[model samples]
Target: MAEIRIENLHRRFGDFVAVRDSNLTIRNGDFFVLLGPSGCGKTTTLRMIAGLEIPTSGRILLDGEDVTFLRASHRDIAFVFQLFALYPHMNVGQNLAFPLKSQGTPRAEVKARVAEVARLLRIEHLLHSPVGRLAGGDRQRVALGRAIIRRPKAFLMDEPLGTLDAEFRDLMREELRQLHERIGATTVYVTHDQIEAMSMADQIAVMDKGVILQAGPPNEVYRRPATMFVAGFIGSPAMNFLPVTGPVAAGAQTIAVNGAHVTMPKLHEPLNHDRGVLGARPEHMELADAASFRGRVFGVEYLGARQLVTVDTSVGRVKVRAANTGKAKAGDTVGIDFRSEALVLFDGRTERALASDLMNGAPVEGRRAAHG
Candidate 1:
């Protein structure tokens, strides 16, 4: 097991900075995931920890030992790339045993380790088959087996399931989490897919634009985002934001929104600025008899269990997730109700989040924007 710590880590490529001012800690036997969009520096951060990419500044410590300048081979960590980089000519057994053999372990021990990992991954029956002909899922298992056979101090994975079909990827997510629990190794997984990170990680660090925005348990990040970037980035279908278009001040009970008179929410303190964005998740809005607003149904998506209905309101377009009762359809008029308990407010000018300490009926600063 390994306790990985990164302090003020940074990496720059000339005029462009890939990762900056990053500080994070991965405890021993923890399933930590680095999540972000492409070019957001998630992968770059992982490469640095694996000793594949040297940081421009900062330090990396493992179990109280500073190994900031160590080479990849000397780090005693296993890295699993997204694309399987196994030897095509070698069969499953050779591929799995290669790492152990490279260390010149006894022949008997290599065989024993290969067999143990193969059984653990449920790929023992394919040990003699050529890796070139294996299915994608099987290939992934072999890749994982190779890493596991070595028993490295820590495991670094960069979207190991990126190439698999959606169905298999889902299955592998559970398998990977189970494997982490069984082996109890320090793991750092990197992926752009939020579902993958949310499902498999014990802790998730959401990254963007070369910064660690928020790092916490998946539920905390989802429920309490620190900024507009995080609030909009972490949720499915994204977050619905309505901007107050007019000038705002510190205290206002009601404001004009989308050409409609809307009541403001009670915040813990008066808002610093009136002009800001109001946020609501689709799942929070519901159809009500005593609706606060009305809009024309623009689109209705049937998601089997529920229907995501988009409405064109005077203020702007709003989406609501309702039961699949099939009563609402496109072109229909519906009374929209905002769940006061589920609303969030953000700063309009900066677009930063204000929902961490507050998530409810928030005051608007100006007229509602057409698009938020």
Candidate 2:
């Protein structure tokens, strides 16, 4: 296993900056994920790590060895692309052995390695099947098996399950998690699917517009986002941002949001900004009979055990996820409540989180609960 470190990483296409000055440290045996929307430079970053794309200015270190100029063939890393890039003419066993054959391994060792990987991936029975005849899931397994048969130092996967159906994708996610546990290889996965990153990664890097916004454990980045962009991008329905006019109190102690007085939380560093916005996730906000803000329900969607209600409030339309209580309806005036602890304040113009300021007591004016 090897730890991958990147420093001052940058990539540019003429005047267009594909990646900014990014730095990250991927520990050994970590199932790290790069998650973001399309064209967010996630793929470009992954390709750079795989030696497929050269960085404009940066240094890549593998286990303390500089490999910034290494070619893909000499990097001792395995990559599985979105498509299952298997040769149609070769059978599963042949495909799995091709890598070892190219490296000129002994015939006995190549056969043994192929059998071992096929059995580990549960594809032993289909080892002789032609690539075109196997199902999508089987093909994907074969592709993975081929990559692992080489026993590379690290594995890089780029949305390897994007072609599978929803059900197959879900199953593959669990399978990949189990596979990672068994092998414990240092792996870096890139995907736009937040669910995959949330469930599988030990650490997740949230990216946007070629820059990494936040990096931490999945829940930390979800519950306490470092920036407004992270708060708006990581969740399912996404966090809601509301504009509020407020005054900057002494020591940044308090702020008024749309006539509602709220106390600020204490911060490690002082924030010297005035105008800011409040952010809350759908799960953090609750519907109450007598609350501060009032809104009309635009629609309600029943999602098995939970229901998602869209409300047109005085501020704006906000989505609230609640239990399936069968009480709320469309076109009804409902009150909304949120825990002060769960609320996130950000600078409206810069979109950066504000520093906390409350001394010892509860920061804001609501019940407190750990989110997520």
Candidate 3:
């Protein structure tokens, strides 16, 4: 196990800056995930750490030793790409033993290691099967086994499960998590799928446009995003944002959504000088019997245990998650409530969070008077 640290990392291509000055510390045996959309520099960051791509300016440290200039073969890292890069002509046993063979391990040891990894991955029965004969999931497992056989200081995975079917992907996710627990190897996984990041990572780094917006546990980033981009990016159904114009209240501010007044929780930082945007997740917004705002249900989607209803309000269209009791339908008049505890305020101009204090449930002072 090894700790990975990046200091003032920057990557550029001529005049284009692929990655900005980024700093991060990945603890020993930590399963760190770099998550973002495509072209967000996540792959570039992973490659730099793997010694496959050199950073324009920065230092990378593994186990407290600087390895920024180390060659890929000397970095002591295992890289698993999205595509299963197995040799088609080789069987599973031969494929797994290839790495040890290249390193000149004794024949007996190579055979033992191959058997051990194949059994660990439940692929021992398929050891003699050709790489082309294995299913997609099996091939992926073989690729992972090959990477693990070398026992590198860290494992770097770049969307290794992107090509698998949904069911296989889900199964592999649990398998991967269990494998990490068993080995406790330091790992840095890169993916655009937020669900995978949320389920598999010990810590998640949310990135956008060559910059990391926030890095923390999954719940922290979801409940209290540091920026509007994160609030919208980290969740499914995303987060809903509404523009409001009003003075900050004494204890808290209230936004006039259409004619309905919705009180906002106090922010730790003053937000009176700039316009405030209200953000709430779909689960936090609900149709209730005695909600403050009234709206008409525009659509209802049945999703197993819960139903998602789209409500057209005077403020805007908002989505609400409710029990699938089959009680709500389109064109029904409904009262909508925003859970104050889950609400977040942002600067309308800059789109950054108004206060980190909101994350910790602290009460903030109001900087302006309320308006009716």
Candidate of highest lDDT = 3
TM-score of each: 0.89, 0.92, 0.93
* Candidate 2 local lDDT, residue 254: 48
Candidate 2 per-residue lDDT, tens place, 249-341, comes to: 335544566666554454434335646688888998888888767799999999998999999977789999988898889999998887666
Q: Which is the leading candidate under TM-score? A: 3
Clashes of each: 8, 7, 0
Q: Model 3 TM-score? A: 0.93
- lDDT (C-alpha, whole model) for all candidates: 0.81, 0.84, 0.85
Q: Residue-wise lDDT of candidate 3 within 79-154, one digit each (tens)?
A: 9999998999899899999999999999999988898888888899999999998888899999999999998999
Model 2, global lDDT: 0.84
Return the candidate ranking by lDDT, descending.
Answer: 3, 2, 1
Candidate 3: C-alpha RMSD to true structure equals: 4.7
Candidate 2 least-lDDT 10 residues: 363-372
1-372, model 1: which lDDT tens digit per residue? Answer: 789999999999999999998989888999999999999999999999999999999999987788889998988899999999899999999999999999999999999999899889999899999998999989999999988998889999999999999989988999999988889999999999999988888888888999888787787667656567877888787777786645544344454556544454544333465576777788877876457578889999999989999989876888899999998978988887665555566777666554222333322221011001
RMSD of each predicted structure: 5.2, 4.3, 4.7
Q: Return whichever of 1 and 3 wins on lDDT.
A: 3
